[model samples]
Each structure stands twice: as structure tokens, then as C-alpha cells.
Target: MNTKTIKSVRLSFLLVGMAFLLNSCFNSAKKTETTEEKAKVYPSDVIPIMEQFSILCGDGTSFKDLIKKEHKDFFYVTNDGVTDWVVYKTPNSGITSRTSSNTRTELGQTETWTPEEGGKLTGTLKVQHVSTSGDARVAASYSVVVGQIHGKEGHENEPLKIFYKKFPGHKKGSVFWNYEINTAGDDNSGRWDFSTAVWGYDMSVVGTSPDTYPAEPEEGIALGEEFSYEINVYEGIMYLTFKSKGHETKTFTKNLLKSDFSTKEAIPQQIWDLYAAIGRDGVERENAYAGEIQNFKQGAYNQTNGKNPEENIVWYTGSETYNGDIEKQYANGCYAEVWFKDASIGPGSAPNKQ
Candidate 1:
């Protein structure tokens, strides 16, 4: 309690008060910055689909943390001066997910189900662009897969690959759905796709050469057009319904538990015509994708890329690549763009027999 001791105590209190004041100012500044950031809304913020599924944005980034923020080269929001749409844009020749060679910026359903214990998935989207630099002879060239029903077990085959494709000289694009048959035996090489068209020729239809063009599909879809699909898997049977504004509404039913392509004679004529030359006439397993785990995915799954044209002429697109630069690819039409206005997922119900 001496004079010098009292002065020392007062100074210590003053120093402590100054330190606390500075800390408060720093915290306040940080809060203000965070509030400003939160003020800006994003597509995910308005849609909030991340509450159920995990998103893989374009540019190979996962939307686990920054779901509310837009990534310029990937997932973002855009309005056509009327309604907002979530755009999923991915380069045809850029970084992709670990499990896939093809680039995809999509939302994967966290849950998995089986054919007997069925599930449902649906998507309403328009493909704005697809790479136009692929080998014309190849079926998958210049195509983009918009939705998928990917199998998680037993060969990991994709049961459904919904595609939109337009060749170099075509005015309209074809919309088709392919079903990859589960191999009948240990040789996975026997797998093949049975594609059926919604509004145009199936995936089997292709030009005769890399530059030659086929006759335009009279009923095909065009760019900027909107379409929808419903995958109602009830009681192990897949009931598909597809609809568009000015196109015919199509409905299909397929048995997932049994193989329709078990014999050569059972193979569809389209498959024989498309795959016979490529040596891919394969039969499905007797017990097709019976007990395998499956899940749903929705987005722009860019099927075209920088793979060599001579490698696999069937699936390799041979798209333009500016040494793997994404910006350049986007400018040269080496990307896939899709916008979804509305989407949903839940239990599937019985299909109405029309």
C-alpha cells in the first residue's frame, strides 16, 4: 500500500483496460465483415438442397463448407430476368472427382438403395451446352449426361445415363436414356448400353465419319429447351416418364431385376447395329443388378474430354483443350452447362398405367 506500489497498480489496471478495448474493436470489425458476407445471397442459399445431398461444384470443389457462396467457374446463380436457376457448369477437360475420369459438377444423394427396396429421383433441367469437338462416328461424342442412377456395388455400373447430344452440323440435339447391362459373368467387358430415345434417335445413332453429319432428328430437342424426367422405381420395376414443352411425352417401363439382353436374339436391333462394329454385343446377367446398392445424381456430368480420339472411339469425345486451361475451354464450347429450376426426391409410388 505504498505510494510507488499504488501507482504501479493503477498503471497495470490502465494497461489491462487498453488491451481489452483493442480486442473488442478487432472482434467488432470481424463481425461486421462476416455480416456483410452473409448479406449476399446465393443459389444454394435460396434452394437449400444441401440440407439433404452433398454437392460437387464445378472446378472440382466440394460444396461441403461454402455451400452458400458461388464459385465463378463452377456452381452459381443466374436469373433470366424472371426466375432464378442454379447453374452447374463444368469444363470438358479439367480436374474431376477422384472416382471418375469425366468431369461432373453435381449433387449426389447421400442415401443408397436397392432394386427390391426401390427409391425415386427426378430432375427438371435444360442443357445449354455440350462439347462440339468430339469424333462424330462415336456414339458418345458431343454428348453430355444430365442425370444418373449410379450403382455403388457389384461392378459399379451406372444403370441410367440420361444424355443430351447434338452433332457439329445438327440444329437439334437428341435426348436419350441408356441402361448399362450388368455383366453376366466375371468378364466386365461384356457390359453394354441399351439406349432408347425420348424425342429423337437413341445413343446408337451416329454419323459415318468424324466430319460427316447424319440426318437431323426431326423430333429432337434444341438448346435452351426445357425437359423433365421422373425415375419411379416401385417394386423393382423402373417406370420412367419424360416430358417437354413442345415434344411428345414419353413413358417407359423396364425390369431391373431380370435381364432383357440375356441372349443375342434378345438384344435390341439398335444395339446390334451400333455395337456389332465396335465388338460390344454383350449380354446382361441373368439376375441383372439385383442386390446392388444404387443412388441418384443430378447435374452436368460432362462426358466429353481431352482423351485421345484413337483410344476408344465410342466414349472418347476428343474435345478441344487449350492445354487443359478451363477458361479457354469454356470459350471454345468445351463445357457442359445445365440449369435446374425445380427438383425433388422421396419415396416412389405406383405408376399410372396409361
Candidate 2:
């Protein structure tokens, strides 16, 4: 072949080789980028127990992959760049359990326990938002339930309801606990809750109107603040400890085997003042929740709802539900968002020191 023609052919081959090399590098880079994205930690990966439980979303859907994947509008994972959190975001008014008006995007334990054979549940979480609507006089206004020990048998009354409440324009919110009475007789009409303030006012403390504000709590929790709680039902005692930075650590102990409010006279003065407005004077079972099958629920079990507050001031908030449209209610600031960093469930352990 002529020298000039051979040189031209060699140059053409050289160009093709260069082009192939560039294409291979680009493909490798793309593959690496996709791998890194897929390897990113997800909500379920951080929450190890998700595989052991069921999740109920704020939009009224129940699924097992909530933690493993993202629901976008409801359950998902987010990072503050410091820590990862599994968010339980549910609307104030949406489809919920048949027995509850409030909606929740939370985890349900697979196991159940009774007072006689106890179990324990623990979690560390933060509240991001609560319903902004509700009458000030109604106990559930501007509040959300973060955790609970719901009874499964009998009237299915909740033995424990942990709450976070803040009034409008307030700088901080209150953290409190409530004990729902296990009805003494077949009638459940007279049931009442005895609230104990942990860091702020209890459920019984209410304002005079929907807009009227109460005195700011001297010590209250702010949004995005972190708190820890351990509900240890060791033997027959329900030992609870609540801890947070810049706040006093509170501990409480209650007997599940015996009834503290077996009779009307045994009810605390707070009950009389709080429930009298609603005509709730129900007495507790003589044995309280003894032998009752109970299970622990951890997540955003919203306390606020869209029912008329006057109809049932204790739980009905009449918050905007957008006619049960979950996404719309979420957009309208009618939802509860809770994020848990860590949690555990197991057989009851020995009580921890205060």
C-alpha cells in the first residue's frame, strides 16, 4: 500500500479506539453514580424493627414496606445531616381505626401482652407538628399523641396516652401523660382520664375559647426538640421515665394490678373539674387493668381530629379534614409528624433508676 494511504488508515483506527475508550469511561462513571444512590440509607434500613411490625400511614393505608421505602406524602426517611429519622406523618383528620377518630402514621407491634404477663416498649422521638385548629377549651386542641399503651380486650380502652400539646402563638408545648379509666360497669359512658403533667399542662387544662391562649408554661418543649421515654411494665408495675435536655427528667410508677380509682371518691380532683363539663363520672374497674390484654403503639397517634369539639371536648378537635382528603389536610397544616431515632420491644426488664 502507498505510505500516505496507510498513514490515513492508521489515523482512522486511532480515532475509533479513542472514541471507544471515552465511551467506556462515561458508562463506568454512570454506573458508579447509580450504585451510590441506591446504597443510600433508607427509612427501614435505619429502623431495624420495621420488619417486625406493621405500619399504618396517615392516608389510611397499612403496609409492611413503609420503612424500607418512602411514601412521599406520609411515611418516609429524612436526614438533618446529623442523624437519620423515620418520619410518621399523619393528618389530623383522615381514615383511622374504627374506634378512633384521630389518624396516625405509626408502627404497630406484632406482639400483645397482658398485665399479668407484661412487656416493655421504649422510644426516643421528636414532635415536628400538631394540628393548629381546635377549641382551646377542648383538651385535644393543638395536641398530638406520641405514644400509647392501648388495651385490646374489653372496651379496648387505652391504659396509657402520652401527649404533647401547645396552644397557638405559644413559644413551647406541654408534655403530659393520661390514664384512661377501665370502666367499672358494662357502661362506658362515664369514663374519664386522669392527666399528670410531665413538663407542661395536662389534658384537663384548657383555655376559654378557640383563640384564647393560656399562660405559657414556665417549662415546656419546643418543636424539633428531642425526648426519650421508656415504658417498662415490669411485673405488674408500669414504670415510666421521660428525659430531655434542658428539661427535668420525670419518672412515674403506677400499679396495673390494682385500681386507684375503683370508686367515684377515689377519682382525683382534676378529673372532677375536667370531666364534669362532659358529664364523665365513670369509675375504674375494681382491679383497674389487671389481666387485660394490652399492646404498645409508638408513632404519631394524632390526638386532634375534625369532629365537633362541643360534642366530645376531650378528643374531638373539629380540625379541618378537607372531607377526609389526606394530602389536602396535610397541606393545610392539619397533621401530626413524629420522628423516632431509636426504639425497642421485648420482655419486661427490671425498672431503671430515676
Candidate 3:
């Protein structure tokens, strides 16, 4: 071997080393890209408090482990160019809870407490869309429930249901809350809900004809308008506070242990008008939701259904469900969508302390 041969061998060794180094660097870069692509943003990532709750998708899928989990097209997180929002979306018709005919993509609190042992839930959200294919004469049509305090026992009635509703072709919608009575006897068929307005008209305001609409509320909330609500159930009393920019702040109080509609005469004229068509004039129990286990639910609980409104006026929205086909319902504007930028759940606070 001469000096030239030794130089040639040395040069080959250097070239091989360079090639190996470049290959290794390329592989490392590819691995990092793969990992980044696999990463996903979940609702629980946006809202850490979601770990304390379980989720029910509009397709009737239930999930107890929500940490870092998401259901596509139902419960997920998205950015609106300014802020990340957790979206809750559901169609007009889908597989619903056995107890309900309507569908929802909502979170149910894992912990349960009685009215006396209270709880508090808060959310800063906006309504994006509502079912646009329901009869205007139906009260529950074109509405979505944003938050609820649902009874776990007894008639399993909802003590509170916060709603956002808009009639088709209307730019502004109404924000309201309803309290369903715990019926006195086993016949739950006579159960009814009484509504109170928060920003616009209450649930009782509806069109005379299926396609007609009432006068647009002057102080109503429009779609994509931001609003916040705090439900603090403390010491058997529910204290509600609603706030929105450029809108008047409203506060309300109602006792949970005592029945305001225990007698037929105590029933509000609104209830009589809304429920009388269905023969649902039953009085509430003497003790309204007292000692009943209850939990909080937050998200989009779609109120529209496909049933004929003539069968039951208050419910039975007579919307176009497309035979429970979620995709068709969505494409045809028969869906509900809500976005929450902030939310929290914890123990209730005393009225004086709040």
C-alpha cells in the first residue's frame, strides 16, 4: 500500500461518516413531524374542570373518562381566531337518553348533591345556531338548552334549564330559563315547565301560525352574542345571575324546597296557556324537588324534535329530523351548536357572600 492508497481509504471513511450523520438527522426530523401530527386538541385540554364530569354525545355515546378525550363532531375544541372555545353540537334527531326524545351533547357532573347541600355552575358562552326547521307555533322549537340542574330521583325533573332560541329568518334570539315541576303523583304525563325570560321573551311567546313569527324582541340577543350565567343553589334556594355586554344584568331567586305551584290556582297563567292544550295542568308536589339528588349538566341540549306539534304543543317540535339521520339533519339546518369559552363548577356560595 502506498501513500496515495492510504489517502484514498481515509477519504472514503470520512464520506461514509458524513452520510450516516445526515441520515440520522433526517430520521430524527421525520419522527418529530410524525409526533406533532398525531397530537390533538381536546375539550378536556381546553377546560381542565371537565375531568369532574362525564359526557353524553348526541349519538348516545357516553364517556366517563373525559380527560384528554374528545368525540368528533359532537364535543371538541376549536379556535375562533381570537379564543379557543369548547363546542357542543347536536342534531335535531339522534340516539338520545332513554329518558328523553331529544338529543344532546352535554356533560353531566359526576358528583350529586341535594338542594340543601347545594352546588354552583357557571359558563361564559354564545349560541352559534339552533334548529332552523321547526314549527314556529311550537314553544320548544328552534331552542337549545345550555345548562341544567337535573333531578336524579323522583320524577327526575329538571329544576332549571337555561335556553337560547331563535325563530327562522330572525337575526336575534331569546335567552330564557325553565323550571319543570315535580308532579304530585305517579302520573308524570301532567308535568309542565314554567319559563322566565333572561334577555328576551320567555318560552311562552310563540307564533300563531306554524310559519309566522312574533315581533322581534327589541332587547334580544343575537346569534354569536356572548353571555354568561351563574347558577348558585345554596341552602335550598336557587340564585341565578345573567350578564352580557351591552345588555342589562338580570338576577333571580327561587326556593327549591317549597312549591310555588302546589295548588291549581298557583299555576301561572303562562303555564295554563302553554300546557292547557295538552291537558297538562297538574299541580306540583307540595315539596318541590326537596331532598332529591341532583346534578349539573352543561352543553347543547337540543329541544327540537320531529313529532307533530298538534300532538303536544309545548314539546313535539315538528321539526325535520330526516328519520334521525344526523348528517342530513345538520346539512338541512336541523341542529344546535353552542360554544363555551369559559366554565367552572364547584360548591355553592351563600347569597350574602356572593
**Winner by TM-score:** 3
- Models 1 onward score TM values of 0.86, 0.89, 0.93
Rank list by TM-score: 3, 2, 1
The lDDT leader among the candidates is 3
Tell me how far the alpha carbon of residue 195 in candidate 3 is from the true structure, in angstroms, after superposition: 0.5
Tens digits of per-residue lDDT, candidate 2, 184-249, equal 878998888889999988878888887787898989998899998988888788999999998999
Global fold similarity of model 1 (TM-score): 0.86
The runs of at least 3 residues in candidate 2 whose Cα sits more than 4 Å from the true structure, single-residue gaps closed, are: 1-37, 65-67, 352-354
Residue-wise lDDT of candidate 1 within 71-188, one digit each (tens)?
A: 7868877877877788889887777777677888888888889988887777788888888787888888788888888888778888888999998777899999999999877787
- After superposition, the stretches of candidate 1 with alpha carbons farther than 4 Å from their true spots are 1-39, 65-69
**Which scores better on TM-score, 1 or 2?**
2
lDDT of 2 at 280: 91
Clashing pairs in 1: none
